[model samples]
Target chain A: MQLDNTDRRLLEIIQRQIPLSSRPFADIGVELGIGEGEVLERLRRLQEAKIIRRIGGFFDSRKLGYTGTLCALQVPRDRIEEVAAVINAYSEVSHNYLRTHEYNMWFTILAPSQSEVERVMEEIKARTGIDSVLSLPAERLFKIRVKFNVSEVPDAE
Target chain B: MLSEFEKRVVREIQGDLPLESRPFAAMARRLGVTEGQLLDTVENFLERGLLRRFGAALRHQRVGYGGNALVAWVVPPDEIEPVGNAIAAYPDVTHCYQRATVPGWPYNLYSMVHRHSEAECRELVRRIGEALGIEQYILLFSTAELKRSSMQYFRD
Candidate 1:
């Protein structure tokens, strides 16, 4: 999609850490020499085009006192979708992906406590009937920051 | 004379940041605007620190840096900065931060290491241990990536 100057500006603002204010759009508009209505409109279009997937808080689960673990499951080729469905149904399972590995299905879940973490794993195992699930919890978090460099976008101007 | 139409064009690109080369031009054409205009706004955002960076989300595992682990250290309050900086200086360490530790869990300093093999990752951790002089730590390997999407704050 051809993103004009205004589109690019709006994207850069929305993707980064949003201003912790009541009217973030208005605040962004004031800085960009645009209006709040315009900010809202451009964001709407971005969503329609599937350029921006979702607008929500990237919470620090650990800070929230939640235990997160990344688990991989070796699901049968045919039952991939079924297993994903079962796994996604759990509110605790926040992020799941289809990776290229012997354990093709990789997912992450956040539990309130350690016992809940085990319970979620057992539930997934029982429901999917997959015995080769590997639960790799962070024994150490060496680095954890989500920084996407959007400034590299070519400037056609 | 930027009206709602022009604003809509801008918002579309903001919410939907495409993962492709010439994504801006593609967006401009869809919104029926000149590429110059799109580039101008993007530049403006860049200058204002609104946009951090734009690049490819490479598959770290496929690139042979598959053995990634999160390591946390229990450092005293006064030592957090020194420990974090020491760990961050390592090329193998991709991420480093300090977070509050629970009563039972005293691990506050955290770092992530990416290597081609698990053994390599462990070796890097060992080097970090020697460099930091802190013994208590844990290695939390990611078994799965449950959710890995950029935050969308503009949604209704």
Candidate 2:
């Protein structure tokens, strides 16, 4: 998708941070030297295009008394969809991906407690009959910020 | 350690914010609080490090970063910090962490790398490996995103 310089800058700035104000869009417009209406219009288009998945507060789950772990399973190629459905049934499971590896199904489960996460994992294993679920919890978090460098994207203009 | 009202605020803002003028006012109407109160709560969350950032969660693939791979590195205990930092320094690498490796699967450090193309992703991975002098790594390319959603803290 071609993005003009203004749209590119908007994407970059919004990813870094959005101000906590009643007129947050206006605040962003002020920074980008565009009107709030223009900012909203561009953002609406971006959201529709699925470029901007969401715009909201990113809370630290751990600080909020939640625990999470990354797990992977070596599901048979034939049953990938079935196994994924069982895994995704749990609200605790936030991210589930089919990756290219022996342990092809990789996912992350976040819950209010370690036991809750474990319970969900175990249930997923039992439901899918994939017992060899590797639960790799984070020993250390070096970084988690997911801001992409949109400024580097060539401007359509 | 949050009050009832604060918890409600957190639940309200955890998902997508409305795209409009005075969004907080719209949210405030739902929560029976003033827009000022909601903004203050969000600011406090930021100051307390409870909220990482209020921003757009982008789809990197749509924005020209099509190549995505999860590279897992088996770094030595003594050199984990330097190697992790080296991986984290790359802007394209969004997430970096040291995870507990299982018995058969022996990869301790993990980094999510994104680039414009598969070749570029491989090249960036090569550069990172060269800089860190760590070759024991495997890149796992995601074939499909089955599920992706933000954590909903207080379900109401």
Candidate 3:
């Protein structure tokens, strides 16, 4: 994953904010003094390497009338895979993880309403036979932006 | 607060955006609007704060980031803002939030930290704790990522 200076610059500028234009790559190319084709080729390579997940719109789920909760459960170590499968089956469970704690199985459920999110959580409890979960819905979003500054770090680690 | 047109735009563009010379132009063509009009809609959405960020979200794990943990800390009510800023200053700490506490649970501040390995992750957490000087915390490392998805506001 040794990214050159240009690759680093592309990562930095692309994530800061995408130019809202017809020829957005060309606009980015103008900044880097590279051709639009070069920009596209590098981006494609990044995607192939899974460095860039996707270049697209990021909307506010809450603002769009959706509610979510970060849920934690004390899952049996032996049953992690089986239980995770059942929980992850639900589309509402956007993020599910096996964490290191008494509450080992953690996940996030985002749905159109509170009732919907609760229903899905309850469903997982019944299926996994876990009685309770720390369903901590955000009282207030203190921070959410997660832009990693590629420019600050060097290529070869 | 989304208009029908805005909702339509979101539904159409929430996936992997096309990657061509004129990517936005391609999207604009698909949405049956001129490139300028589409850009205006996006700008308006941004100005109004409907869109949080419009850019490429890199997958850090694939980009050489190792283990990640969700560390929940019990912070005093008075020191939340300063402590939160301190925690968020670390580049490895991607998401930091003040969440609600349960009946017995005391953690109010939560942070998602990434590092090259578990040891590295713990070291960073320890440093953050020493810097802030207020820490009753637990690190919940993610052993597996079961589901990670972008919220589809319109269709969903």
In terms of lDDT, which candidate is stronger, 1 or 2? 2
Residue-level lDDT of model 3, residues A60-89, one tens digit each, is 788777889999988777988898889888
TM-scores of the candidates are 0.52, 0.96, 0.93
Ranking by DockQ: 2, 3, 1
Interface RMSD of 1: 11.7
- Evaluate every candidate with DockQ and list the scores: 0.09, 0.74, 0.67
For candidate 3, the docking band is: medium
For candidate 2, the TM-score is 0.96
Q: After aligning candidate 2 to the native by TM-score, how far in Å is the CA of B83 from where it should be?
A: 1.8
Give the higher-DockQ candidate: 1 or 3. 3
| Interface C-alpha RMSD per candidate, 1 decimal | 11.7, 2.0, 2.0
Model 2 lDDT at residue A5: 86
Q: What's the best-to-worst order under TM-score?
A: 2, 3, 1
Q: Say which candidate scores most in lDDT.
A: 2
- Give one digit per residue, the lDDT tens place, for model 3 in B11-43: 877888888877777788888998899889989
Task: Evaluate model 3: give its lDDT.
Answer: 0.83
- CA deviation > 4 Å runs, candidate 3: A151-157
Per-candidate Cα RMSD to the true structure, in Å, reads 12.0, 1.6, 2.0
Q: Give the range of the ten consecutive residues with the poorest summed lDDT in model 1 chain B.
A: B54-63
CA lDDT scores, all candidates in order: 0.63, 0.88, 0.83
